[model samples]
Target: MKLYISLLLAAICCNWALAQSDPLTVATFNIRYDNPNDDPHTWDNRKDVVANLILFHEFDIFGIQEGLSHQVNDLDVRLPDHDFVGVGRDDGAEEGEYTAIFYNRTKFKVQESDTFWLAPETDHPNKGWDAALPRICTWAKITSVNAGQTFYVFNTHFDHRGVEARNQSARLILEKIEEINTESLPVILTGDFNVGQETEAYQLLRTAPGMKDTFDAAEIVYANNGTTNSFDITTSTERIIDHIFVSEKINVQKYGILTDTYHSRFPSDHFPVMAVVNW
Candidate 1:
C-alpha cells in the first residue's frame, strides 16, 4: 500500500511538471496561394522558405489562410511531424482555398475537428453576406500530449471584398465558439482578418467577451510591423490585419510579426503573426 501511494504521487508530480514547463507557440500565416503571376514569389519558390520559417520558429501549431489543396499537401509533406485539420472552402472538399490548422502530431492529438462556412446557410458551401467568395472557419479540439490539457483552436480567413460579410462572419465565429465550447475550455483564434485594428470587424472580435488579442495582451512583443508586405520586403506599413486572439484564461507571454526574408525576398505577401501562450 505504501509503494502504491508513492507511485501515485510520483505520477501526479510528473504530469504537473510537464504541464508547467513550457508555453505553446502559436502562429497565423497567410501563405499566398500558388499564382504564376506572382512569379518569383510563387509557391514552388516560396514553400521552402515558409517551411524553414515554421521549423526554425518551432511553432507547435499554426493556422494558415489561402492555401489550396496542393499547397496544404506541400506543407504536410514538408512538415512530416505535423498534420492538419480543414477542408476546402468551395465545396467542403479539396476544391478551394483552405483555412487549415496544423498541429505537431508528436505533441498534440486532435480530439474533434470541423469546418463551417461563414454564411447564413453554414451547412453548405456558398458565398455569404454579399461576399465575393466563400469563406470558412476550420476549428479543432486538440489535446497536448505533454501537458495532458485540451484546448480549442479556430482558424479562418474573412471575405476580403465584402463589408457586411466580414462583420457577420465575426459574429458567426463567436457564436460557433460559444456553441461548440460548452466546457469553456481555453480557446485560441488565429487568422488573416484583412482588416486593420480600427475597423468595426476588428473591434467586434477584440471586444468580444472573454477574448483578448494576443498582440495587445502579450508581455513581450517583437517585430511589431504591419502584417501585409504585398511581397515588398522593404515596405513597413503600420496597419496590421493578421491577428491571434485567446481566451482570458490563457496568459499571452510574447507576440510578434515574423518578418523573415530569404535573400531579401518575402516568402509570402503577408507575414505570419505569432504568439506564446500558456494556461
Candidate 2:
C-alpha cells in the first residue's frame, strides 16, 4: 500500500509538470456582420454555435471582426465569464461594427484597453483614403493569472474595398504597435485583412518589424485547411485573408483553422484560426 501511494504521487507530479508545458491557445474569428437579409443564416440562428466554438476550444485570448453592438452583447450574454475591449467604428460607442478583443476573465486580469480609428481622424469615427466606411482597431493590455505574463492585443478589420486604405491602415497599425509596444513586450495583432498573403500589407506584416506569422513560425501546423468560407455553404478560400501575428517573444507550438459546422450549417462565414504558443 505504501509503494502504491508513492507511485501515484509520482504520476501526479509528472502530469502536473506536463500540464505546465501546455501552450496558451489564441484564436481569431470573424463572426460575419448581423445582416437582416441573411435570414436563415442570421446571427440569431447561429450565435449559439459561434459561442460554443469559443467555449469548446477554450481560447485564452481571441479577436473578433465585424461584430455589431447587439452581436457583441449577445456573445457577452451567451459566453459569460469573458471581458472585451472595443468601440463602435462609426462613433466609438454602440454605433457600428466593432473589431473587438476578448480575453477569458478567469485566465487573465485586464490592465488597460483602447480603441482607435484607422484614419486621419484616428481619434474620431471617420474614413480614411477612400475607405468605404469607418474602420478601427480595439486593443488591450492583459496579464495572465496562471502564468503571470503580460501582453498587448490589437484587433482590427481593414477596409475591404480600398486598396490604398488597406495598405495605409497596415502602416498606421505598425506605427501604433511600435509606440505602444515600446518595451517590445509580447504583442499579438489579429484581423480580417481582406487581402491575400501576396499583398504589400500582408508582406509588411510577415516581414518588417519582427512580428512572426503564427502559421509560419509554428513548430507544428496541426490544422489550417483555410480561414475563409463564404456563406454559400459550398464556397471556401485558400487565400486565407484573415490572420494572427505574434511578436518574436512567443514560441508557436501549433497552428490550426477551426472549421466546424452544426448539422450542415456553419457558425460563421469565416473559419476561426488559432495558435498555441508559449513565451
Candidate 3:
C-alpha cells in the first residue's frame, strides 16, 4: 500500500512538472489618453522612448488600453516587426479610443480579431458607457510560430465609474469566454480592470474555474509586490490596477510590473504589467 501511494505521488509530481514547462510571454499596458497635462513628457512626443521600452521587454503579445487609432498606427510604424489589430471605440469611424493588441509577427500569427463595447445596451461595436466616453475589449486568436499552438487573448479596459458597468462587464467577458473559447485552448485575459484586488470584478475573475491570476501563481517565485499604477501623474505612486490572468491550463513562469521610470517620463499614466507563461 505504501509503495503504491508513493508511485501515485511521483506520477502526479511529474505531471505537474511537465505542465510548468510551456513557454510564452504577455504584457498589458493602459496608455492613458493623450492629454496635455503630460506635456513635454507625453506619449506623442516620446514615441521612440515608449517603443524602446516596449521592445526591450520582448513580449510575445502586448495589449494596450486607451489607444487611439493614430497611436496604434504609430506603434505599428515604430514596431514594424509586430502585427496588431483593433477598431475604434466608436463604431468603425476610428474616431474614439481603443483597446488594442500587438503580437510579434515573428512569434505569432493573428488568426482572428474583434472588439466589443461595454454598455448595458451594447449592441453596436463601440458606444460610450455612462461614466467614461466608451470602453472596448479586444480579442485575438493567435497561432504560435514556433510551437504552432493556438490560444485566445482577450484585453479590455473597464469603465472608471459605474460600478454596475464594471460588474456587468466582468460577467459579459466571462460569458464571451465560454461562448468563444470552446476549443479548450489556453487563454490569457489582460487589461486594466480599474478595480483593486478586492472588487467584485476582481473576485469574479480570480475565482472563475480554469482561470488563475498570474500574480498569485508567480508571487512565490518573484518578489514583485507592485504590479501596476496608472494614476498619479506626478509622483507615480505604485498601485496595482493592470492584470494578466491566464487559464489553469497555462503555466505561469515569471511576472512583474514594469516601473522603468527613467525612459517613461509620461508614456502613459499606468505602468505596464508583464508575465511569462507556458502551455
Winning model by TM-score: 1
- Model 3 alpha-carbon drift over 4 Å, by segment: 1-22, 123-130, 219-238, 263-266
Q: TM-score for each prediction?
A: 0.94, 0.91, 0.86
Candidate 3 total steric clashes:
3
- Candidate 1 lDDT by residue in tens digits, 181-241: 9999999999999899999999999999999999889999996589999898757898999
**What Cα-based lDDT does every candidate model obtain?**
0.94, 0.87, 0.79
Clashes of each: 0, 0, 3
Global local distance difference test of model 3: 0.79
lDDT of 1 at 267: 87
lDDT of 2 by residue, 12-80 (tens): 998776655657888889999999898788999999999999999988889999999999999989878
Better of 2 and 3 by lDDT: 2
What's the CA error at residue 208 for candidate 2, in Å?
Answer: 1.9
Q: Deviation in angstroms for 186 in model 2?
A: 0.2
Off by over 4 Å in 1: 1-18
Evaluation by TM-score, superior candidate among 1 and 2: 1
